[model samples]
Target: MRNRHAKDITCTILLAALAVSAATAATAQDGMGDDDGLAATDLDLSGTDLSAIDLSGTDLGGATRLKPIVVEARKFEEPIREVPFSVDALPAEEIEAARIRNTADLVGRVPNFNFADTGLSFANTLNIRGIGSSSALISPSVNYYVDGVPLPARVFDQRFMDVRSIEVLKGPQGTLFGLNSQAGAVVVATQDAVPEFGGEIGVEVGSHGERKLDASVGGAISDRVSARLSGTLYGFDGDIRNIVFDGAGNVVRDDKSVREQYSGAISAKVAAELSDGTDAVLSLRHSRSRERPTTGVWLDDPHFPRNAFAPVPETTTETTGGSLEITHDLGFATLTSLTGISHYELDLEADLLDGFIGGAQTGLPPFAFGAAGANVRRIDETSSQVSQELRLNGEIGDRGQWVAGVSGLYSDLESTTDITSLAMANGAYTGRLKKTNLAAFGEVTVPVGERLRIIGGARYTYERQQFGGTYAGRPGGAPGLAAFAESQESTFGFVTGRAGLSFDLGPELTVYGTIARGEKPGGYLFFNQFASIGIPLTEFKSSGTWSYEAGLKGSPLADWLEMSTAVFLNDTSDEQLFTFNPVAGRFDVQNADTRSYGWELTMTARPTESWHFGAAASLLHAEITSGNALIKGNDVPYAPGFTTSLFAEYRHPLEIARRAGSAFGRAEYQHVGSRQIDPANSRRLDAYNLVNLRAGWESDSFDVYGFVENVFDEGYTTSAYRAGNAAGGGGVFAGIPGSGRALGLGARVRF
Candidate 1:
């Protein structure tokens, strides 16, 4: 722990020195906000046409004060104060200032948002309000979207290079979005075509052979048309040290895979004014990643990647999608039509006892699996989806607003897995699934008076799904059955809704309460390892959750400090968990009832023009209320007890090449409490703390910055599961190690 103490001391000294330098500066130069005035009251909206105002730049950070912000989160543009819920909107400025490279960075910035980084970007999972599944294949409580199209898990981990805005809505958002959002939703809007010719180019290089090049170009093509094109290419060699050990349990050597992974993505879009009252936009995107996958490590020895033997598997993933949206004005109302399609593919070739499962398996010694080279695991997966929706939005003179929509979706998934490991009895599995869904949803807000409002919404959905798969059995050392193929289909119908009340104590404060129901349809999982035996294919039932929340928001300390607080309780039934089967493969699935209660706080302060602070905290308690009697009271898997983030930044003027520029130093602290990794409570991931530091200088046209993440090099694990390397290592566990200390430099230019 001495090294940890030293890191803390070093961080303290550096930050103290920077703060001192800022305070003792001879002069301070005005920044972008100097003339504009950073205060909310100082905003000047005079002479601007509210009807044509942009909603993409809305700042909904604190519900502390009610401002006339037009936000487009409910599939319709509306005043932020009237939403009567929790929503955090971060535009391009905040994205750039925070140096948020990917969706994972959003965890600390928002209360109750959690991300589990499983080393494989494509396999990460997002959770909100202490609710998440142990595996990625299950129906997610929280969903992700880009523009208006839902993103499959295979591409949800893509980098955010040309993002324009991101909006996070907490709690059940089933009525507000088109996707399967049982818990919450994250919506991302990439940079769109601008009326003027403009773009940016950026380059970044960091440790572990990290290199990135991203660029974007956009301009008006005609009086009524504009187009934009953006792309990003990045590569990272492996950082985890793979150690080879002898029978004596001693590390003998290290394996390094340098310059072995790369990824690239491109997005293109065009916007047009078809007529005086009509507009349309079309967008397309493609992304691909080819990498030597990071096999996991032992949780107790995260820094020492023992038995992460290779020839490493080469995992390749690709995603392509397109979307079109059209809007028309009908005098008293507006009509919108949207259609989208997406395709995803994954190809993985791995080893059973070595490169596939990290560290240990079945609690057996790592050296026992030295000859696992003969055991191979190969998988190929493909998925595609098509969605269409039509909605109408309107207002009632001086009363309130309303929106209604109808949407339909169709999707297909296919996968094949072959495992030659002796532990699995030399088996293979293949599966195919198809789903079709249709739904109608509506929401309305009615003003009860100048200080009070009532909001209500509901949705009715019909779903049908079909699944089929086969297991190739081997009759050998383990019991086996004849190879059999089976197919099953299921149908479901459900209704969900939300109701709320909001009272405006004044222009600066509001109190609100809401109760909503969220749900996920039940379906068949084609590849259950247990089903390979005499067990029949079992279809899980649908799940539902009722969330009740009450909160207060406002600027209690006047214009400089803004804060919000909320308390919530959730009751759920049939929550699904997909995980590794202790005896064989990774497709084990189950369900349980759960209860969770939590309180959250978010604050932002600008005590002075040169200093800024932001903080958020989420304290929660979640437990299984029922289902399996053995662990009925166990804490919900992967649901941390608490999470928090604190941030501070100081800005000062600097003389660069005889020109005035801004220099800034920023510090951030984030923490996640410990939690169980499985419903059975056989394994757990300990709490972890991280410190990140950043410093930079920038002008209006360009910026240069450097950052050090995980400055303390704290050892942690992002995920833990049953290990496959051990013979009978059921009690022992292995995990995907979290990132270590890494520093990097970056530069960007805008024209």
Candidate 2:
């Protein structure tokens, strides 16, 4: 392995050298620096004096810009310091260059935000302020959105392309964004089409036989219309292998698994300046993605020694959606209306237990009777949703601004399961579900004084749900129990609100305090005949208290440094808890109370024109406050007590090689604290940290780079499955090990 890695690196360096030697005559600017046309002057902000200028009202997007401005938490468009909560904003350029594959990678670097992969290629989970569920089939306490349009919770296969920026709003955001925000919200904004003609293409290859290609184009279709198109192509041979037998009963499924993904979107924008001072814009966006198979494999096994490379059956998922939005600037503020529709299909199958069930089994009765064999379990499902929202924003007085809105949504879902029950014939079941929701909300912020501002808002929401199903257990011992379920509906309503105060302590310091109430809707679950025939399960619901607080947003010691820190307390009631009943073979939801408190600190520094450093650290304490009889005050499932990340980058002028653009190097360290699989806290995962290194040279139109992940080749487990153990597996079946130290190289070009 060592020799192979060394050869790969050597080949990469040789190729890079040849490319540089062939194209060394062009003067270039990568556009990340200042556009003043001054060589290396873009980095001059470090030593410049700012005391003489009033930078209070300057639009950072234009002056010391990053990219498109984001207003996810705060309604205003000033610096992030003005908001009274923890927030992390990363733009497209940084995301692309850093090779952040998904939302998990992005939040893994931020304080107080933990995104955990579920081992499924498409579905992911998040933990914020120690408040998130670890279950793969339940709705998340956190809310997610794209372009101001809220998405259905737990729809994990959604992909992001042509994204302009991602804003993570920490803390409860129930006032404006009700239901599903008891923890927080993530907003994704995509780039819009412009009147000018421009486009870019990027391609990369990396570790684990990974390869990716992306392209985007935007321009005007006519004088009053404009359109933009973008597409992504991705393929990778997964690191894990399946070592199971094939149809020929041959020992196959070694690291031979592969995945392919494709996604595309088209956006259209229309505008016409009216006779008045008001202008309007109508925009539409549509996107879809098809994934070959999302497979999860165990890292180790006893029965199947080579099971790590087994060939699991193939599965697929498809996602398609469209959105329409219209906005008019009426001088004082803006009036916006948005409508969206989405549809998804999932065709997945897997052997829940990694080991073979029947044929040649040693101590299994089913195997003795030839009642069961290596059969696949299938979960086939489809869902559709539609939503509409109308909002108005404007200023009330010289010191006050307000926003009011209303929204409605409807959803329908159907799921079918076909299990080749080794004891019987192909048994199947079908389930159906429908849901509707309506909400109204309003918010206002007022400047109480020159140095203080007050904010408050409220929202009222109602939701309803219905379910029906039928199991193919007919003619069996259970009898013909036709699921002629009648209409069963329930209405859930809540008023969520927020209040906060912000004070400007000094020229470079600000402090704030806030209290808010967050809420989540209730919904039913569907199951097959294997589940007990008893009373219906309780719908899940959770409510919580969010107290956010203090710290500074600007450099307190020097103009070249900026820092922010905060402390928070989250007291949650009616916490949704899920428990499995072995006798019933089903999971039920109930209400409990929990308390979580934490602190976060982050720092960004640029000491010289060639160096930049940033670091963040977080600590959390979470436990169940009530329902001791049930959970026994266990720590939350996915919440880690401590996590930290540190990163540094340096750029140097290649005087020896005369490289038009400076060469750069980066290094990062990430540490995650211990976590437990069950609320009992009986089982725990040890703490571990990972190191990564990257170095590259980029020019005006092209870039070549190399990266090494898991530099120390540390091995650790991310998540464990209970189904494997239930099936009589001796070794705990864990999925997706943190890959070992691996190296790869890639290049990109844009025009």
Candidate 3:
């Protein structure tokens, strides 16, 4: 009887695991799924573009477990449900429907991600799972990539123009993505060239005199070849104005607004079939974008003249990138190779303070020597990367499936910056920075019993960095100036890996546990002006983290609802950090041990054929564990307390003048909790919630929609930057306000 009871319990657990797996598969397949092993009838694969194909069947219970395109979880391209981690997949359709503009707009709407500071001109900084490096000058705690290519540091925070799907990989991912991806990685997939004739054009008009237009065309040039190209144009007048004046004082409100952004891409693909039931495809992509900004917004008074702010002198960014990938399928597994190259240039000219005049404004010390000129920066950056991945899969014992793969990555980057007091003027200082990295990685998976699978993976990485810069000082070396030129180069390497187990119960349930180690390489602070002080700065130090996670994913009651929950803990040693001090008027690089643990829950349900509801929430706890004397037990900067998003969409069938598409309406609510402004945990930001509503009608030929964001126009700050008052009269930091509520209308046509 005892043995029988144990067998029954084991079987029950296995069934539960299977159910979770199914839900996970379903979720991964379509970004939505239920608990049952059935699909949804409302999901018409043929009625929509195949690119929108989320799952094979409408019965979403099995959708989340399928392997997705463009990404590999564990060792295979299988669905995210099998990866044993929380993944928020944003499909191209959803992104288009939501009209997301930049990376910061993705926060709150995506799981485990948030952005605290978003002021026009103030770089959009992002935090993932309660961990982010607040300083934009340093490499981000989370890595950002476009079409499998990393964006260089100087261009990392630049706005995104043309994009398709955006995938946020939460938690440490050093094994696959490498040292800079200790916290997580974001992947942006551009729209690929379609094989069939298709095209789309869209235009949007909204408040603040905002205007945007996007267009794309794709078709097959020959039976065996295809191509696609897309472009976007956007412009907006500044909503806030600078009421302050120059020495002339003639009510000079700086028109610091922006009026330009452009992006375009083209791709071609060739396919060939082999005798051994194999296929090969070679493709290439090229894209570029540029933008000009007057200056970020700032106000001398927050009460009456709220609209007062001005664009400084001049600011601009230009980016160009391209990639080529070749893939061959040998019946059993696929071998793929990718090569990418990119270049970027940025130029800026700005009045240091918009609220305070440059002259002797408010008794503040000037950054310039003797004369106060417009602060200007000109930067040029370039990078190249090549990666190759080979995957092999085979059936094991006729009851299990197995997969293994090896990957190699090589990257090189070089950037140079020129600083001056005015646009179109001679540069005052010049600095150069460079980094190179190489990595080799492999992973394997094997099924144990009928219901269990074990997986293991490891990666070895080598990284190097070089920094050189020159700073000139006035005669006699001013009190705050240092008379020295500096340069440094360092190299380091490390290994990281992961091991995990997955158990499958019923067809609709699954349970998984995983432990992984990830690392990030540290480098010299060449531009870190404060390093010259006696801060004991190190040339190079590697930061590493270990993550522990356990989770259950499955459908609970009916086929219409599915849910996933996970608990995770992350421990780190010598974590990289950038700290800002208001009193010292300085920014410092430091290291500390830290611990982070959190719980996440995700749910998706289709109560009715036309109605869909989804929600994801995460509660996080992060604290300093040891190693830092200045900040021993303080919370990590830029980490939000909690983040959540809830969305409901309804589609209604209509004649629509005899057209076949449907009309849909969606309402979404996103919430970000209050957080500490600095590591010391002194000032606190108020929690805020936003409501967005959209209504639209779409068919194979056309789409029309309208939306309202931040419907209530609530006042909030997305981020803060410290402007140390060494003279000690004004406030230490300035908070940039989030954008106000705006409404817009849009239209899309396809041919």
Top-TM-score structure, candidate number = 1
**RMSD, each candidate, Å?**
5.3, 7.6, 9.3
CA lDDT, candidate 1, residue 308 = 54
Per-residue lDDT of candidate 1, residues 582-657 (tens digit): 4544455677888888998886554445666567788988898876564688887777888977777777878799
In model 2, the worst 10-residue window by lDDT is: 47-56
Local distance difference test, candidate 2: 0.62
Model 2 misses residue 78 by how many Å?
3.0
Expressed as tens digits, the lDDT of each residue in 1-751 for candidate 2 is 5643653454355345423422321112233245433333222232111111111121222222111123546544545666667777666755664567666577666777876666564356676887766554556778778777776664643556788767778888877776578788887778876778878887778777777777887777777666677777776665544444444445443453534345555554555444354444555555554443324434444432222212254456665666777667777778777887777777766653344332222333221322124355677888898988888888756756788999988988887876654434355666777878899999888887777878888989887877676655433323333333333566778888888877777655567788888877656555443421423445566455555555455445443445778888988787666555445556566566778898888765543355555678889988877764546588876688999876666677563345477688887767788876555454566777777788988776677789998776766666544333323434343444556677888777767
Angstrom error of the Cα, residue 310, model 2: value is 7.8
Give the clashing residue pairs of candidate 1, or none.
Answer: 64-554, 361-723, 361-726, 362-728, 362-729, 362-730, 363-729
Q: After superposition, how far is residue 162 of candidate 3 from its true place, in Å?
A: 6.2
Measured on C-alpha atoms, candidate 1 has an lDDT of 0.74
- The C-alpha stretches of model 1 lying farther than 4 A from their native spots are 3-70, 243-253, 258-260, 301-303, 355-368, 371-373, 473-479, 579-587, 724-730
Deviation of model 2 at 102, angstroms: 0.5
Relative to the true structure, how large is the alpha-carbon lDDT of every model? Answer: 0.74, 0.62, 0.60
Rank by lDDT (best first): 1, 2, 3
